[model samples]
Target: MSIKKPLDPGQEAVSLCQHHPREELCYSCSDCDGSLACPECVTSTHQGHTLVKLKNTPDFVWKKLIEHYIQKAEKFEIPKILKELKFAEGKLEQNRKHYQELIGVVQQRGEELKEAIDRITMRHVNTITEVAKENTVYIEYYQGELHSLHTEIIYALRKCHQANDTEDFSVVLDSEKIIRAGLKLPRVPITQTTKYRMGPSPLPLLESAFGGVEIVGYRPKQLGPTVPHVVQKKLEKPEPPKPALYSVVSEFRHLTDITSLVPTEDVYSWISNEEKKEVVLLDRAGDVKQTTGLSLHIRDICTSPITNNLWCCSEYDYSVREMTTPTNTEVRLNFPFVPRALALTHNEDVVVGTFRKVCVYNMEGEEQFMASADKLGRQIVASPQHISVCPTSGNVAVVDWDEQSHDGNGSPCVTVLTSDLQLLFQYRGPQTRALRSGKSRASSTRKNKKEPPPSFWPTDACYDAAGQLFIAERTSKSVQMVSNDGTFMRNLYTDQEFSPKTVGVQTGGFLWIGFDFGIVKVIKYKQ
Candidate 1:
């Protein structure tokens, strides 16, 4: 709880030397061995050696050092210490509350178990009482029969005794003979009730009743030490001053009518003309390795993140099929709308962008959700040309091109939607200087006729691991790299004959772009 008072800046900067009374210790000689040498010593033996004036040095350095200490105290050091103390106190309070709550829960559970046990004991007791009553009835009936038999015997004995007392020898003898003939123990049987006691406790009975209390816990994770400035600067990647440019490294010719391009672990797979009914997987050398045939006309194809199979969308049948092997095809889903663009998400879900809506489906082809309208009930997608999922954010991005709008002056734009079909960001790429300067659309078009168009009509889109989007502009024959949030990052590729239509990022930093002339270009953009 103690705090050190700060030093005053107005204090004297230079102090006087203890040995020299007249001069201050403002200057020192480098040659003087471990002793504070005055100006006289500097002029005597250490004239040639290096000498520095302590007072001549900037006072700001000392001031800055003091300020840095204060800054750390006020900003980092003191605050961090206080935070640790507060956190410790909070943990103690939380532990106390948790202990009380746990006890309450245990007591409540015990009471419930006790009630159940009492009910079970009472049921047994009731059964025992009823059985005892039934036994008593049976015993009473047998006792009554025995009593009647005893009465019959007693009456006979009394008659015989009276005959003997009256001196009637003949009658007494007759009675005795009759009594002897009839004399027999009562034949009524008596029944005994068996005793019972409550049995021993079952071994697992307590465990089953209470479920054995368990304490599960979690504590906030402690953060690692703050990175030093020198180390952090090295660790952090410097943002490109201007976006980096991509150059063509290689090209594959002869694949005609290429529509979709996808790259895998060791090869690049692409779909060309539907009439061929085949998807070609090419090695790094652009040599055909495997050709998988499909029955339907494939519009787009992406590598499934789950099965690592080739997932193809047929625009003709509006069907989604998974090409498990080279010859095996599993029809997963048939959609009402024609699926145009397809992208496999990190979670292995298939994201399809159709004519008017963006739909998400699992690998089984079950429709999960759709983003057809915006928050204002306005149609969000018009003609979705391409779809890509941001790996970092899991956001589904769709490029919609409406050719019929504004008399075909429609500028294609990108729409980013959440996994749950909620809108995140929609942008029409970067604004042009002509548009920003309040120029008319016609004038701007005329002015930019000779130059590359300010914005591109999105033909295809794909995202890299760094969350950068590579969009193919068919008109300009170029591919632009954009940020996940729709900021224009850089032009990835522009070519005269290629006319990039669809693009894909490969294992390394190589880009596979399919062009209008059935050419596939593999370009390296990053190390």
Candidate 2:
């Protein structure tokens, strides 16, 4: 679009070159647009006009315009066509490589499939052929005997009529008698016995004769169940001396899901003496077997440090109870809300957390204090299992899990609260966000909504041997441990699997897992 050209003729100031020297230089009009009229008489009137004194016809300007058109054609059209042609060539090469590689894999797989088909077809064909051959041999032998008997019958009958005396006395046997005898006759001269193994064929063929001829045959009889007879041999098993103290003398099946694991001083003694330790377990259906009123769920269970007895929380019964060895009894108690987690502090106070509050009780189930609830709103009431009575703080740390997601309902959190229901500190991890903001929370509880609950559900929090706090997350298939400060520890998975419906730490420094079934295991760490 630009009009300027590269060539510059600085000034046309000189009076048009008047001399026609060398027969090339000529005078032109002061203005270059048209021919000059007789050299314009050399006047100053056309001084500012551009003048041309060319030495040749149609000089540089016309040549420059032709050059610009040639460049535009080469740049715009030729290079684009070349790029497209190269791209097509590369695409074809790539396709060839792809088809070659695919051909080998397909051919190899097809061959294997063909061989499998052949093997299966041949097995069936061979079996059918074998059975047909056997039947043909049997028919030929029987038919020959029947034909011979018929021929002999005719000759004997003729001889009897022509005998004229008792010379040929005995009667001739007909084909019918021969056939009957063939079936009944035993081995007069010993013959090999033949047994046919059954194979695929029409049922009618099994009874019909070869060559489609009719023959006499008998139906087989039915038999009873077969048994093998053998001589008897006996061996004795020696009995080991039973340690009356540690042996499991009784077993209860399907009685209850084991809810707590309690280890004994006797088991600890065995551990110190370089022997395997045995753990005792306690489980409950959660009451005095009452059928009415509030239905109690066995939320949590623990062993009393002072009495070595089992204690469990029951929502229906609203009670905490101590059970004597392998047996439980009802103890009247009241909890602030439905108890979900239970903790026994060093001072022996029973700490339990439920909807929006933590309640403290004595060994006898008497209320000590109704701890904090302000920080926990309707949004966060009860955690699955995260009520830990901190020995260091004497304050309870309750981990709520709903708010961390910034969800209307699912603010997942762990709040440190005082003994008198006062809010102190709060901790939260990443929470699954609410699918719809400014919506009701109850909708989030639906199973298929958005985020599924993690496999790791909180179970209990306690101190390790070093007094460092730790936590347990349990499931039907796994049990994992994490530091009480919410630090992740190594996950435990392998060999033995336990439902770990609940967990407890033994006074003997072992970890106990409670199964949903009526079984329990104690994992003792060497370290």
Candidate 3:
């Protein structure tokens, strides 16, 4: 006669539904409480119900179930169970051997007592000693076998999980096949040798013997931490709200050409790059308060909102200088490349934009971090012409000019980065029709093909008190306002009177726009 093997769930070929066994179940009905459905069923019975496709679920329940069992065996259950079993088996073997030795000693003592005591008492002692050892050999044999089987089971369990985890189907199949065949515990039949009988004690001097049998209970030791330590506390002083800046305050027009501007609490400092004599500091009324003269040829300047210390970079010396006062000037750090632009971070670090990359340096001139390339290993800044840091978010904004872009016109784009130099996004501005310059289309095509004009050639950028970025393009006279996330908000200015070059935000939220012809506008651009 032929025999059949039972079906295994692991090897079972799953079907669509119990009723429509041929069709595959691809989706589950959401409204009908997870009822299995095929495409045909979706149109029929489950037409109105929202359907969730099986393919959409990244992790299947079967995979999770297998993982759970494996974790239980490896991390918690198997090791603990095996340890306990081994401990119990050791105690059982030790007790059994100890009892046999004790029986031999007691039997020798009983033989001596048999000579001294009456014949009846001697006979009873012999019967009792024999009864105590009748099941010792059989019980010990069973225990040893049980321990061996437990060890095998533990090994098998570990191997099965390891095979399952490694996705070794053949190993797992072989293991489960052996397991299902059943490795039962060895059956031990106890043979009755002697009956339970009262006996004269071998150790007659001691009334109660056999280690004074006692049931000792165990209480598990507590593993929780006894000492409570507080790690975090709520901030006592919350940050104050940022003031709104709306509309232009006043247009501060100057006679000298202004290259860069930095706003302090009481005054605004404008650097005339054309002149090497001094940096002019003016009050709100456009009155010159002081003119700080230094040895460096200032390319850009920035003042801290917290501290009114003036920081300026020189193109000729390739160094950044910090000026606490007009007379007190110190060369902070010297760089190989010229520092084109500068921004002061909240922690008083100076973010210097060099030829190739943007670098953040502390007050002691120690380099903290840099943004030379993006997360995907793509170079972010080609020529970091201008840079700005958001006071609130600490996000670094840079206007990089691509020197090799578009037949030498230089394609410029703004890059927004986190304080840690992670590239959040790069804004290239709106995709508009390119405005061609230089040669005629036909003539350029005949000689060298003409390319589109650079869309955003931003010369400088500054962040307002509310963390809004203002980009000043070289091509346009207007200053474009952008959100901290690089979203273009609106044009802050579009006037023929001034051609905006570099921009700065004053302490009281005034937008300071410096023009090529020494025209500086101190306008409020936010509400």
Whole-model Cα lDDT of every candidate shown, in order: 0.70, 0.47, 0.70
> Would you estimate the TM-scores of all the predictions?
0.49, 0.36, 0.48
TM-score of 2: 0.36
Candidate 1 on 288-407: residue-level lDDT in tens? 877877776787778875567888888788888888777898888888888888888877888998766888888677889898765555566767877887766777778777443422
Ranking by lDDT: 1, 3, 2
Off by over 4 Å in 3: 1-248, 274-277, 405-409, 430-453
Worst 10 residues of 3 by lDDT: 434-443
Candidate 2 local lDDT, residue 329: 54
lDDT-best of 2 and 3: 3
* 395: Cα error in model 3, Å: 0.6
Residue 428 in candidate 3, Cα distance off native in Å: 2.5
Query: What's the C-alpha lDDT at position 185 in model 2?
Result: 25
Top model number, TM-score: 1
| Clash pairs detected, candidate 1 | none
Listed per candidate, the RMSD to the true structure in angstroms reads 26.9, 35.0, 41.9
Candidate 2: residue 265 lDDT (0-100): 38
Q: Which residue segments of model 2 deviate by more than 4 Å?
A: 1-256, 262-298, 324-332, 362-381, 384-408, 411-449, 474-478, 492-499, 515-519
